[model samples]
Target: MKIKLVAEHIYNQEFSIERALNWILNSMTSEFCMRFFHEWLEIAESGTQQLTTPSWKEIIELKEKSFSKFNFRFETNSKDKQF
Candidate 1:
């Protein structure tokens, strides 16, 4: 499931990274997300000139953090399990 978390910085006009972090952490538990991260890692590690132009660190870290925070389980008999 996708979730959106905006900052509630109505008082001092400050944003909360924690809120975003929490939302991201929640999204990381999916198998699809995990696969995406794996692909992202591959691209990041390629060391090609084109891939180095944009910073992939933030994207990788955020998604990786989400995946790291939760554990996924599959009930498989043949090979892959159904959700």
Candidate 2:
């Protein structure tokens, strides 16, 4: 629910995704935070439209930082198993 709105804002360039990430990190304080990132990625890759290169790069960098900072392990049901 909240994640969907944030992802929509990201796609629309209404605010910095990094700012949203920071807010989630500071406020969520639970495994639930991962859902926000996952939902963003899912929406970005859903093929309704292509992300601009800069937006894509930003997402990748933020993902790496979040995973490393929190020691997150990504699991996907998709056979390709890619993030």
- Scored by CA lDDT, what does every candidate get? 0.46, 0.52
Model 2 ranges with Cα > 4 A deviation = 9-13, 30-83
Tell me the RMSD of model 1 versus the true structure.
16.1
Q: Write the per-residue lDDT of candidate 2 for residues 1-83, one digit (tens) a residue.
A: 76556455544554344564665566555544575567566656754576443367666665554452343232333353222
Please give the range of 10 consecutive residues that has the lowest summed lDDT in model 2.
68-77
Task: Write out the backbone clash pairs for model 2.
Answer: none
Q: Can you give the lDDT of residue 72 in candidate 1?
A: 32
Q: What is the lDDT of residue 35 in candidate 2?
A: 56
In terms of TM-score, the best-performing candidate is 1
| Model 1: colliding residue pairs | none
Estimate the TM-score of every prediction: 0.25, 0.24
